[model samples]
Target: MIASTSASATIVEFTTSHGNFTVNLHDETTPITVSNFLKYINDGDYDNTVIHRVVPDFVMQAGGFEFTGNFPLTAIATDSTIQNEPVYSNVRGTIAMAKVSGNENSATSQWFVNVTDNSAGAPALDTTNGGFTVFGEIIAGMDNVDTITELSLCGTTPMPDYTAEQCSDSTFVPGTENFVTIETVTIIDSTVDTASSLNSVKNTLLSTATPVTPTPTPSSSSSGSIAWLGLFFTGLIALRRRFR
Candidate 1:
């Protein structure tokens, strides 16, 4: 499901159930993060994966779990965690890695797209957890990403194109068709090699004190799993702990 272009290659196209979008990787500025992403793509680790987390006006996340025709999504196999590369800002349309709360270098495979300007928004990602590593930006098909964000949530999972009526129907039986699936990811162009203008923004919110794990609410699902409890709550609490 992953292929390279003959030309200078740096852009990757994601074909999803809703549509397609292309991302220009920050190969020079965030080499470690970019290389980590490409390894998962080349290994076919992202194929058939579902965008398991969607918070309206926040972030739409994927690359952590895959659907195998069942409930409780399967966690994708991960390599060792990569070093933190917080060189860029988490602005709108940018893509960043999701990691355990307080651990700057804990990013493995899970990633999220900023639906809003997270750097200046409620979750000032630039100041959180050594700053979420922004490694790429959506170059084209941002409308598709916007459409995906508008999809309604069924519990914590976003149901692609499923209407509110359909989601509210008690008789509705959710299936793989209901989930937003990443069909294929191909390297469209590789010529691009520059970082965004938003690069070099240092993270000043990283704390040297030991990280204190928050008490898990009774409703809290285990960290790294897709069963989120609420919207911003999970985005803040779970993602901070083990959402990756």
Candidate 2:
């Protein structure tokens, strides 16, 4: 969901099928864009949206499609396209809004995750380029994005002309189901409570946890039995010597 312009550079939480990601929204530069986006998020609009287009090492797009898995056919049905907020480049892990041909301001619901830094591909003001609006960036769980980027895409090249809402027929490079789906998108106002503190603790615990290993109790008992057996053998030998 998009957030209000007044929102703190809040840490938004997206619980995806792959994993959870905390994104820091860039509300300062793109207030209107962010507000529009957070509106749908607050309204539960982006939930269950399929990552319809997957350009490996490039970007994965979603959010324009319906919650029921259908994309709007008419241009008017989708919200008005937003003007280019190109202050932020198409850097890796940045979230940018997607728009149709000839309508840069018409970016309503759909957005894309830039898997790689495509600063050269940043939407330009001239007619030749379509500048993608970068509103926020992924703060955590980039491994999930990397995993999705490495997944098989429908195209041979990393950048393809496939701009549809959903690409079910499009095959992955390795024919694997690596498509990213939005299980749920939640706007977390960091000003209210810093939830990322818990994430840091969790990461620390994961890093310092005890390794999984079997205890050596049985091995110690066997060694003790062997020692007793050796002592018994030595005593018998001494007894035999005495008898001799």
What's the TM-score of every candidate structure? 0.76, 0.59
* lDDT tens per residue, model 1, 1-244: 1222233346899999999998988877777888888888888899998888776777788888777765456788988888888777777898988887656677888898887777743365775566678888888898998888777676546775566666555554557887899998898766655444434444444443233333324342223222221212243212112211
lDDT for 178 (candidate 2): 31
TM-score for model 1? Answer: 0.76
Summed backbone clashes in each candidate are 6, 15
Off by over 4 Å in 1: 1-9, 161-173, 192-244
For all candidates in order, the CA lDDT equals: 0.69, 0.49
lDDT of 2: 0.49
